[model samples]
Target: MPNLELLRIVDSIARDKNISRDQIYTDIEQAVASALRKHFNTEDTTEFTVAIDRQTGDISATRNGQAVPLTLLGRIAAQTAKQVLIQLLRQDERGSIYEEFKDRVGTIVTGTVARFDGPIMFVTVGRAECIMPRSEQIPGEEHQVGQRIQALVREVRDTPGGVRIILSRSHPDMVRRLFEREVPEVGEHTIELKALAREPGHRTKIAVSSIDSKVDAVGACVGVRGSRIKNIVDELGGEKIDIVRWNESSQIFISNALKPAEVAEVSLCFELGRATVVVAEDQLSLAIGKRGQNVRLAAKLTGWDIDILTPAEFKAGVDRLDQTLKSVPGVTQEMCDKIVALGLINVFDIEEVGAEPLVEEVGMDADLARRVVERCTEEAKVVAAEQEAKKAAQALAAAEAASAPPQRDARDEAVLAALGLTPGRDPLEKLAQAAGDDAGAEPAGNDETAKLPDPRQAVPGGAPETTVHKEQPVSSADTELSPEEQAVSLPDSGRKAGAAVEHTEETNADTAALAEGRAEPPASPGR
Candidate 1:
């Protein structure tokens, strides 16, 4: 019965591992037979072969056509069978994990958090554990043990430890997969995902187009009442997603990429992949987003160097350049207009070309061209210096902003008031100041915080009330005390009261000795 039970276990392992039951049984037989032959030191003429009965699960081994002794299957044979089975199961499991997950990379998968190895999390997807490294995790998403999660299958690494299933929540493609998951048309290939740019956990811009002319790609991705995309947003912990229809024309595509903002015009230099997009002054804020996020995403999505300029700013730049060129002698309005027409729109451009190129392109007088170039060069230096100053100012402002102390909110101010603390004042500062003024204070050069001997604690009998004022006179009663009694510490009576106490010569001498100590100055050598 026990031996038959082993057969059932082998079948279970085969199903779990997706391994052949016959192969596993054969491996067990050979390992046992090998161990037995080695233990018995079989003769040179003998050769071993092992078999497992298909139906009965009984094992048999022969040496040169003679049956080997059953005693050959001892402790050694059991250990060998265990080693072989473990090795086979591990290898099979690795193969299954690798095969099942390798092709699934770049796709989303659901898993459960199984464990944590420092910053890396082990998420169990089916029978395999996937690795979610800290680098690939969403910024603020905290995972806990046994929590169900969904992440993109980023990579599958076959390692000596095992098959590594690496997953990611922060990959740009993960958002693409999420869209495909929620939008049926995307999954079905009716809607093609043309481009995507993402700052994970912040925002994503995706361009989608439909193969069928009748289908609205953006509308489909958005769904009716945004129901389809809402599922994805919830799954992403509310990360913002922008889906727009893709356009073949670069101008139209760029305008669509910078959404939620109205664009006045888009001029493209396809050679440099540059797009100059003009927006109304009011729409400029929306076009730039917070910290240029909208423009940055637009640039990434369209594969262009996007420059967002308000209409007024563009006009101002053009007018300023025209006026600067006219200010230079030998550079006439006609000359400036010709330069603008040639796309040499700024003084720096003219200065960089020098007089030779200017003569070749504009056919101006050689002497005049040289003067204009020299003047432009001087003006360019001033502009460069101004720009450098502006940049330095901006850098200083940014540094200040980063290092500035946070302004306290109303609640925080109220709490501080209730605690009797002023803004910018440490709560314990007054207490420390008062402590410094006390007799137990640390020594300083001044009387306050100075370490003076306290006679009250050192004396046998209670001391008489006395004043600590330096200007106060000692009384006649002080001079009557013995050298031993001088050590008694007196309580500080008010300076005003001690000022009335009369001092005799002997009393002053005794008070001096008491406060200063009895040690005499080193006896001077006989002079």
Candidate 2:
């Protein structure tokens, strides 16, 4: 009856903990064996086996295959067995938690806030608790104990304490998974989330596409009258979301990326992967957003370096770039016209694509290709010089205008070190420093002659044919022989093309040229 009761307890634990019955039974058996070893002080040498009968629930223990009376294990062994069983069960529970959550990483899970350990918070996720590290938490968002929340499972690991499941609210996938949860079309594979850029707790820019033509990707994600997306926004503590339509054309995609402000035109430098976005003067502030956040997020979303500008500003910048490009010496008027025709109107654009665009794509000559790349390389240095000069002029103006100091970024310090002037120091020093930088940045040789074509195997039109020959030894006797008889003494007979080798004919004297070391005449019997 006691054995049946023990079996019943095992069954109950197996069902409640979602652990296998065999696993529970095995743990119980090991616990009994462990208790026997502890009580008998034979943990190392003596072996003990414990088993439970499947049908009758009869339990038994043996020492070296011999039966041991149950009475031998007193209250002391029973207490030890119970303690061991609890420990083993806890271990099994932890193992179960790890196995359950390991595959669940990069997915959303709900949990009640369990407790806090310093900056880290613990949330009860079903059978186990997950940790939300300080870095993974949403910035400025507070959590209270017993509050239910959904978080993305960022990581799960086995640690000394047990299975540690790391949860995250700031992960980009959290928003993606939330959309998958709320928007049935996303989960149903009708609408696909293409690219996601998030500044968690601030804003998120998601590019989504639709597989079905009838289904509007952005509309479906937004739901009917913004009901579906509103739920996600609320859950994220009112963090703003921009849902952009994914397009095959990057220009269109980038145009879509800078939404809510409306883009007037997008000028793309494909080689450099940069897009100069032009917006109306009125829309400029909206396009740039507060502290350039909108443009910054748009850049992140499109994976392109974005520069926002007004129409006038863009044209002025274009004119400046075109002037800087012409500074490349060896650049002729015709070549410059061809370069503009080929869409390389700026120096950085040419530098980005290298000489390949001019030669291969635009069909420029090989010599011109090398010259163009060199010109662009030099032009880049010139542009940098002009920018530095402009910066110095601005600094001088600022010094003359007011006594207020300017704030600078820490990363700028490393760059400023090379300038020989600190941020707030003298503007006069910067003029010399800028000149020095330009001098050092110049190519080793005169920019025009510095870059030359590599040794070419295939010249334009075609390469000349090359002839191969090996040296042959001649005897002194051959040189002493008559021109006609030189062949017999030559040890080999040879004929030349287009020349008669008439044997009657004074032994075909052309052969003797070898003996005299003179040029061989053209002749052959086959002619």
Candidate 3:
């Protein structure tokens, strides 16, 4: 009866843990040997041996070549054996889990959000539990307890605690695996996913190509009416995905990579592994995307450093390159055009290529190539300084605009008019009018000097008078102020009170001058 019970227990554990029956029998033999050692108080393992019969599940033991009765091992020995058996069974379970999940790495698995330990989430995937670290979770996505979650098995580690399976939802491969699950062509190898770039929750770009010409890789992946891609987008919490066709040519690939923004031209510089993409001015924002996300992902998907430019900027760069090359002593217009045709868009490109490419590719004399490179290097430095200064000026202007007070608009003017106040009339004039009304005096006239005190009048101590200059007739060259002058003249409100008063007087003067045909009103400063 006891032998039958032992066999039944072994069979049950083997089935539950998915372990081999033979392995369980071996564990039972070791457990019996440990019990015998405790019973005899023998430290030497060689003195005792234990075995379980394969056919009958009968456990037999011997001490120093003498048969030992199993019943005589006592209750304490049986309890010790029980503990050892439980421990061995756990190790076998862990080993089984490790072996099973190790091959599953890079594959997607669906699981329940079992529990959370702070930011780390533990998910139960089939018989094993996996960990999803905070870094692997998609940004702005949250899961509740028992929620269904899908993630890629990024890694499986045989840790001391057990099998540690790490899950990731933010990995680029996660998108690839999701496509394989949603798109049948991908699974059957009819369509190949060449590359993928992702910004977790924001967006993803995947490049695909078809092995069979009739397959239509992108169309098949997208499905009818965007049904297939829609399912993927919903699964990714509405992440915008761009599916682009893959091409062997880098220029074509780059142009396709930056889709939704038509590329006017694509210039490739093989020496630098860079692509200069020119788009129409209207498509510039679309190509760059919000905060440059579009071009950034395109660069990753195509394996090239992408520089996006509008048509005007592209023409300016090419023109600058032509001028710089022509300025070199030995470089003719034909040589410059040849260099530009080689994708040297600007002085920076020539500087990066050095003299070797000029000599080998451009077929220029060695000494002349060196001179050309030297000239280009110096020009590149000057261009870099100019670009840096322009960027700085733009940043400063943006800061000032952000800090300046809001200007009064038509709505504000309407509100003032409703309150019985003139919109554009000066505040000081309003005050003077109130004083005149209280004293029973006539309201001030339109005469400019009578309306306000003269700033040019000297104070009692013969101190230098503060003069308010009238707005001069601004010529085309003097229309815009320098950064330093703008900073000094513009107040926190963006328009100085004195400047406003002077501008009113200047407008009257310009009106008078135009009526007498003395001068054309200075062209309103370009917007």
lDDT of 1 by residue, 340-440 (tens): 65545456767766787668767788988887887778877987898899999999999999998777788877877887668656557855765667957
lDDT of 2 by residue, 298-366 (tens): 899889999888889667656755565466565556666665555454667777788876776567777
Clashing pairs in 1: 455-489, 456-489, 466-493
Model 3 scores worst on lDDT over the 10 consecutive residues at 444-453
| Each model's backbone clash number | 3, 4, 0
Give lDDT per model, in order: 0.79, 0.81, 0.88
Question: Which 10 consecutive positions of candidate 1 have the poorest summed lDDT?
Answer: 489-498
The model with the greater TM-score, 2 or 3, is: 3
Q: Give the TM-score ranking, best first.
A: 3, 2, 1
Clashing pairs in 2: 496-523, 499-522, 499-523, 499-524
lDDT of 2 at 187: 97
Evaluate model 3: give its TM-score: 0.77
Off by over 4 Å in 1: 1-6, 41-46, 319-380, 390-527
Q: What is the TM-score of each candidate against the true structure?
A: 0.66, 0.70, 0.77
The residue ranges of model 2 lying beyond 4 angstroms of the native Cα positions read 44-46, 320-345, 396-527
Please give the lDDT score at residue 262 for candidate 2: 88
In the range 335-360, model 3's lDDT, one tens digit per residue, is 88788778889898998889988888
